[model samples]
Target: MKDRIIDCLAYEGKVSIKCMSSTEIVEEARKIHGLSPTATAALGRLLTITSIMGYELKEKDGNLTNQIKGDGPIGILTAVADSNGNVKGYVGNNTVDIPLKENGKLDVGTAVGKKGMLYIVKDLGIGKPYVGMTPIVSGEIAEDFTNYFATSEQTPTVIALGVLVDKDGVRTAGGYKLSLMPDATEDIISTIEQQISKIEPISKMLDENKTLEEIAKLVTGDENIQVLETINPEFKCNCSREKCEKGLIAVGKTELEAMINEEEKIEIVCNFCNSKHIFTKEDLQNLVDKI
Candidate 1:
C-alpha cells in the first residue's frame, strides 16, 4: 500500500490526531542503508514520526529535523523531513544486531540506549528556527517524543511508533500522534485514554490493512471524527551534485588546493542518501577560481 498520513479531529474537534502508514518508507531506508533488523526497527520508528511531524510544517520551504544521540551501538540516528512529509534518514551504525526481549520483540530501547537526548529543530523559512530538546525517557522513539512534547513544547500528547521487520524487510511500520486541545473535556480525555489502552498496536493495525482513518477512529473512540486532510508521505532525499559543490566551496581555497594536490579526484558522499559526487582536478581548480 502507498504511504499515507491522515489528519483528523476527534471528540467534537477537541482533540487532534495524525496517523501514518510508513511501510514503504521504512523499507526504502532498509534497502538504502542495508540496516539490520534491530537497526531497521530503530530508524523506522524515528522516520515514521518524522514524516508525520514534517507534514505539520506550514511554510512551503519549511523543514524539520530529528536527532537521537545515544550511547548504544547505533550511536546517532538522524532524520530530515520536508513540509510535505517526504523524509530521508541515516543511522550511525546500520549493522547493529542485538538480542530480542523475552517478549520476542526487537530490543529497540537497548539498541538505542536510554541515556541520551532527543533534539527537534524546525526551520519555518522565517526569522529564526525553533529548537526544542529533552532527555530520552526511553530510547523507544515514541515515549521520548511524548516527553519532548510535554516538557519542551508544553503540549499534552501521546505518540505511538512501531516497526515490524521480517526476514525479507519491513513487514509493517507506522505511528500516530494525538494531542488534546485546551478546551478538551475531562470525560472525553478519559474515554480516549481508555480507547488507546484497548486498541492494538499501530504496527499490528497497519499490518492488518487498517487504514489511517480507521486507526484514528479506533484511537480516539470517536466514530464521528472529522477528517481534516490526507497526505502522501515519501522517503526522498534532496541531495544533489550542486549541493555537494557548494559544500566543497565552503572548505576554503587552501583546503581545496591541498585536496587537489593529494588526489586526482575527490569524492563526497551524502550521509542521508549515500549518493556520491566526484570532483576531478579540473573541477577543483574551477571552484578555487570561483573562490
Candidate 2:
C-alpha cells in the first residue's frame, strides 16, 4: 500500500494517537543515502518518528527538529519535519554496520550506543524556538522517544518504531505513537498497554502489509480508536540551484569574485538529498554583478 499517516483519538478524546506506515518514504531515504541494512533501519525509524512528531507541532507556529547524537559508530542521525508533512534527514555515518544481536535482530542499541542524548528543538515561528534534551534510554529509538516524551514533554507516551532492510535496501519502515492525555483514565491506560504488549513489532506488521489503520486497531483496540485523518508521507527536500545561488550571494560579492577567479566552477551538494549544484565562472560573475 502507499505510505500514509493516520491520526486518531481514543476513549472519547482521553487518548491521542498517531500511526504511520512509511515503507516507500523510508526506502527513498535509504536510496538517497545508500545506507547499509543496519544504517537503513536506524535512519528509517528516525525519519518515520520525526514525521509523526512534526504533525503534532502543526497546531503551533513553526518547525520541529529531532536529533539523535550517540557514541556509537553512526555518530548522529538528524531529521527535520515541517507542519506540512515535508521531512528530510541525514545520518552522520551512513556506512556503519555491525553484527546482529543474539536474537538475530538489528543491534540498534549497540549501533547507536547507550550513551548520548536525544535533542528536540521546536520553532514556534515567533521568538526563539524551545529546545529539550533527554538522556537516551535504549538506543533502540522507540524507547528513547518514549523517554523523551516522559522526561522532556512530561507526557505519558508509548512509541513503537521499526525499519526492516534487506540486502537490496529498506523493505519496510514505520511506527506508531500512543499518548495518554491528562484526562485519560487509569483503566484506559492499562487496557492500551495490555494490547500493545501483545502485538507484533510495528515494522513486521507493516512488512506484512498492515495499514496504519490496522496497526491502530491492534494497539488501541477496536472499541476506542477514532480515526481522524490520513496523510501521505514522503521524503521531500527544499533545496535547489536557485537557493544555492541565493546563498552564494549572501556570502557577498567578494566571495563570488574569488570563486570565479580561483575555481572554474563552484559546487554545492545538499546534505539532505545529496543533489549537487554547480555554478560556472559565468554564473558567479552574474551573481556578483547582481550584488
Candidate 3:
C-alpha cells in the first residue's frame, strides 16, 4: 500500500489512535542517505512517528521537529515534518553498522544509545515554539517517545515503531500512537493495554498487508472505530538553492567578502535532501554587493 496516515477514534472516542504505513518514505530515505541497515531502522522509526505527530498540527504553517542525540555509533538523528505530514530527515552517521541483537533484530537501542535526550519541538508559527524534552529511556524511538508523552506532556500514551531493512532497502516501516482521553475509564485503559500486549509489531502488520483501519481495531480491541482523517505521507524536502543563498547571506558582509576573497567556489549541501548548491566567487561578490 501507499504511505498513508490514518487518524481514528476507538472505544467511542475515548481512545485516539493514529496509524501509518511508511514503507515508501523509509525506502526513499534509505536511498537518499545511503543508510546502513541499522541506520535505516533507527532513522526510519523516527521519521515514521514524526510524520504522525506532525499531522497533529492544526495550522498549515505549523511544524514539528524530533531530535535524538545519543551516545552510540549513530551520533544523532533528526526528522522534521510539516503540518501535512511530509517529512525529511538525516542521520549523523548513515554508515553506522553494528551487530544485531541475539534475537536477530536490529539493535536500535544500542545503535541509538540510552545516554542522551529526546527533544520534541513544536512550532505553530505563532508567538513562540514549545519544546518538550525527556530522558531517553531505551534509545528505541518508541520507548523514548512513550516517556516523552508520559512525563513531558503528562499524557498516557502507547507508541509502536518499526522498520525492517534488508540488503535491498527498507522492507517495511510503520507505527502507531494511541492515547487515552481524560474520560477514558480504568476498564477501557486496561482493555487497550491487554490488546496492545498481544499485537504484532507495527511493521510486521503492515508487511502482512494489514490496513490501518484493521490495525487500529487490532490494537484497540474495538471492532467499531471512527475514521477521522486519512492523509498521504511523503518524503519531501523543502530545501532549495535560494534558501541556501539566504543562509549564506546571513553570515554577514565581512564573511561574504572573506569567502569571496579566499574561496573560488562555495558548495552548500543540504543535509535533508543531499542537494548541492554551488556559489562561485563572483556569486559571493554579488551577494556582498546586495548587502
Question: Highest lDDT, which number?
Answer: 1
- Candidates sorted by TM-score, best first: 1, 3, 2
Q: Is candidate 1 or candidate 3 better by lDDT?
A: 1
Clashes of each: 0, 0, 0
Full ranking by lDDT: 1, 3, 2
Each prediction's TM-score against the native?
A: 0.98, 0.95, 0.98
CA lDDT of each prediction against the hidden true structure: 0.94, 0.86, 0.93
lDDT of 1 by residue, 1-291 (tens): 889998999988899999999999999999999999999999999999999899999689999999999888998999999999999999999999999999999999998999999999999999899998899988999999999999988899999999999998999999999999999999999998899999999999988988888999999999999998998889999999888889999999999999999998998888988888999999999999999
Query: Which regions of candidate 1 fall more than 4 Å away from where they truly are?
Result: none
Model 3: per-residue Cα lDDT over 229-274, one tens digit each: 9999899999987888899889999989988888989998889999
lDDT of 2: 0.86
Error of 2 at 188 (Å): 1.1
| Full-model lDDT, candidate 3 | 0.93
lDDT of 2 by residue, 1-291 (tens): 677889998888888889988888788888899887888888888898899988878755567899999889988999988875568898988888899999889888888889999999988788888999998887888899999999878999999999887777777888889989999887888888899889999889987887777888888875657888888867898899999989999999887888888998989999999999999999999999899
Off by over 4 Å in 2: 59-61
